[model samples]
Target chain A: MSTTEPDNVALNGPVVGRYRVIPLIEKGATAGMRPAVASKDVQEALALPGTLVADWQDKAIKRLGQLVKQRRGLRVFLDNCTKCGACTDKCHYFLGTRDPKNMPVARQDLIRSVYRRYFTLAGRLFPWLVGARTLNKALLQDWYTYFHQCSQCRRCTVFCPKGIDTSEVTMAGREILASIGLGQQYSQEIITKVKSIGNNLGMKPRALADVLENLEEDILDDTGVPVRLPLDDSRADVLLVTPSADFFAEPHVDGLIGYAKVLHQAGVRWTFSSQASEAANFALFTGQHDHMRDIALRIRNAAVDLAVSRIVIGECGHAWRVAYSYLDALVGPLDFLDPAHSRVEHICEVTHQLLTQGRITLDPQRNAGKVITYHDSCNVARGASMGQRAGGQFRIPRELLAASVPRVVEMSADTTKQKTFCCGGGGGLLTDDMMAVRIKGALPRAQALQSVVDSDEVTHLVAICAICKTQLSSVLPHYGLQHVQVTSLHHLVGDALVL
Target chain B: MLGYLLTAAFVWAVAGSAYRLIVWARTPSTLPMPLTPAPTSRVGVVGRLLLELLTFRALARADRTTWLASLAFHYGLLLILIMHLRFVWSQLPPSLVPFIGLSGWATLMLIIGLSVLLIRRIVIDRLRYISSPSDYLHIILLLTLAASGTAMKRLWPVDLYGVSQFLQGALRFSWQPLPESLVLVVHLSLVLLLLFVFPISKLLHGIGIVFSPTLNQRDAVSAQTRVLSGSSHSKTRE
Candidate 1:
């Protein structure tokens, strides 16, 4: 729909190539590339269009009606957007892909147009005039292609005049897609694993226990002290819920080690619960409240069973948002716990607090070799809070970096803090199937990161979100920043923690 | 007959707006999803909204150019509307009497704002690409109305006393002769068109922003848990 069709040169160039500006696409460049959803996964999740319902069009419309009737923000977001384009260039995907539909307003219009044609008075009367479109196979295909392209980063929301969050709109879009059994395989599979196995990786209690024990042994071998990674200990004071990736994946696992060392240093009795091993809730990515609630209940159940006074989440971006913002609301009345402390906390906040009170000594000299910069995770920056203060989410991580790292560098002003760009791997687009868009969507972040690398020989890029770490690790290499090591904020904390 | 038509248009605008708002209010947000770094108190929420309304705070941060032009347009319209209150109210506070002298300038400010917005829409790639036929229509409609109003002020001045008497009479069910000027007729007709489309078109954004959950929800103890239901549809269903 954009009048400015992208030049063919930009379209053919490598995603990492230096460009004066990313151009907007004409059409069909991305329309054919849709994330596939397995029918079996749909059936298992009990989401709609499970191959049993051949009439996906009706099921989709019915789901849309349910969302419009239920979500207050969705109703306003759908009905009110004046298409001001305040958020047009704001989305990382739009900047990367140059797909006009990736522009927040145009993306919302994908569903907004359909919603209008079926639901609104003007749309029903003058569909073309109001830019309303009747739902069809081709449009449904566009839903998958473009909606998945969005990382649900909410960078656009910070600048929107109406405060319409494109993440919220994309969530609703994904939810509607899920309803008709057309959900993305990456997120749907993760939700299935989480629903059945308690973690996104589907790691069982025994394997998780083995992983923690191995980490403890490794920590003990590295340092003479007996640092512990307690597994499912009922007597622990804090129930630490972290992403399953921390148990296996590099850098993430290091962040997990950082949490263990911090908890150990503070002498706070904390343990990981096998039953609620993952903090990154894929339900959020899929945008189903019921699914999110049912999945999140495992965390509460784990806390109740362990009888922990507090729940501290490790470095996972969307998980932090789900916990810090949505946890108490999703499954609440956490009255059994102590009233003085918040029910859920970020590991960075815990470390920051300990650093503030001098409970733990951090030797920033330990990280002397690296020039560091911190990347604010989308969900944490825009969707959640970390400490008692208002902008603590932004402050706490940087404060930790300041306390624990010797030399720190700031990125360009507009691209950090509330204006931070997405790492292009969040909102469940972390799958290999979505690699093209992930690399493309990462253009803004790469540009921002590439700037600091040139200006100040920044060697290390630290992030607090798991998806950001993983996404950046894979995508940054394309931009010739393979030398810029993307590690966790807690991994930095873990490195700088003194015996 | 014109008075009755105007009354019907106003009623349509009001009722349609109320229906939309009621539907929005009735829909539960299910979770506290305030864009973070938000106000923690109800009073703080009010303060945030006030800042946004009075200054277009979010717009200002997002795009400075649009923000300045929008401010010129909206505040100018506010001033003009205040001056126009004389037609509906027999008299206003004497302090406002001083501002009435500036209505012509206010109208000029509105035209200036509308013109810039229109030019930006045409010139900017991102805006032009995302813009639809309806967006241009909305601008053209407002620009035409503003042009007509400006014409009435300088080039084709209307019978002000008669127009006021007619509007005032229409409100109280008393008949007054319609003002006999083409510019005034065009301006009045455009006003009616705007009001009629207020609830139907993107013009509803004025009301829509008030109910936007991102703008209105509180971050303080974000666990307003009792309202968050997993299957709200089951509970809401008749």
Candidate 2:
């Protein structure tokens, strides 16, 4: 991206945060983001209170106490923040809304205030001094409005001096809300679908099979090969667990096609299971440990049932974060599977390995007209990894882009790696209800993209995460770069794969 | 006696910080939530954390002004704390005696550091909004402490031997006359109050950083290696 070094502000160098990254004091820009439709009766599945109880405040506090005791990260984050403001402007929501509460530290304070009142000695003695507040209906409302504003992207965590990840605080807040019979409809419904129908769209086995069949026919028409999209194949060597969005949505489905083409070219047998159909775990958004465990178990069960040796997580950001970072803890050990492979594998890791070994070749000229820049999805960049190195998550996608696309331009160094911005719609905030937050949140990425479009003449923007694709596509036009459409990293790969 | 007040503050600060540290360690980490591009090894994590603690490196990247002010304040605090060991310790370790001589300039550094932080809190709307009354009180308290400490250092010129003897007596539970200077009394009283509030206030960040999952965690996530990484991951609720 062409970073504009404003002469007045750029005293020495063009800092990444020179323009529009700083919060401009727009109070209530995000305050009215609205409570997402709370889930109905579905709370029973998560063993939550079925409805708002008379003792809802007590229930929420009790749940917070349980979470603090159960989750050390949450307890420590609540205790550790110094209000140094390192993370004050780090949140995209805060940048977008300028609502001070949208700031990560302030958003965290929504619950930490309650934590102080109940748990800390200073808050109990002199609540005003520590910004502590007792539980109340109005304050609980603030908990929902502000915490939901967070995408749980972990962007703020990167810059926090204490490394206090506000996402953990947001997750804990959501968990407390659910305990008091308040839950996000978007996340809860998705979790219920994964629990009941095996996918987020509630796509029954027949529907999923039909979609795969259509995808296979499309691949055959395009490539003139009998490339198959295998479903529940018992003889498969790899189990491909991907977000259902990739099975149905544009750009996302192209990534699915890319996976199949690569697997077919590499001569590796892989299959997708309707049972473990969803790689995107909504339980992560809800912060329900038991539900997160149960959802991840479906993958373990599917691997066992399908008799696959390896499980490859698809190109969804948060899904990869869960699969790579939390799968072992959530689903127990992978001893049942083959030991030669990693316990959990990212789809990009698998594809990168193939590209490295010359198992497949790409004709970069196939994407000749497109100048591309990669958007490092937040969850994968900060919450997950690829290859064997620490920053492999950032490297592998760009490497894939470079190998597959002819003209690849790097976005701002600041916004491309661990400092990447969220796609606004992650953390289960991808529903229609949070459109305002989504649009505002997309501003920083949109500006970064506009700079690239102006300087590098970058035409196509590509990202690995499904949420980033969908969010960027929907939101970029609002910022005047309507010509820029977000595509999948593997879409380019599918385009360039030399048959 | 002032000894009892000093003892209470010492015991509370140590016990409170330790108590929070212990609770953080005991609670289940549940998942590996390392902010990535994170170090993949324990040594790497330590090195990165040390850089952050020592330099406020992340703040340098996020906001340069905060980093400069914070670096000055914290390092200044460290140096000033060490300089005070002249009064606290019966005798300085032979090596530290050399560094203690830098206390004159370190006081200026401390005042400058605290001033920038205080001014930012007063001027920056964002910081002003995020800061509580106690945040202001903290800066004011520390600034006043520095001013009074400076007055004793240069203006009042209290009996150094008597003050050192008084501190040693407080630690040993054998009282000694605290050099009978109003400035010394003001400085010591503020120091005692700071210690008493350190653990209860946001100052817990001093200890909490060690147990912070995002900072202390390694980037590598293997189910088999989960034990070494997430130490308290045993699921008790389930």
Candidate number with greatest DockQ? 2
Clashing pairs for model 2 are: none
Candidate 1 displacement at residue A153 in angstroms: 0.9
Candidate 1 residue lDDT tens string, A138-241: 78877877888888989888888788988888899898887766667778888888988999898989888888889889999988779999988866878898
| Model 1: residue A226 alpha-carbon error in angstroms | 1.4
DockQ of each: 0.38, 0.41
Candidate 2 local accuracy as lDDT?
0.81
- Please, what are the lDDT tens digits per residue for candidate 1 over residues B175-200? 68888887887888888888888888
Indicate the residue-level lDDT of A135 in model 1.
Answer: 94
Cα TM-score of candidate 2: 0.94
The TM-score values for the models, in the order shown, are 0.94, 0.94
* Model 2 agreement with the true structure over A37-63: per-residue lDDT tens digits: 465567776677677778987788888
How accurate locally, in lDDT, is each candidate? 0.81, 0.81
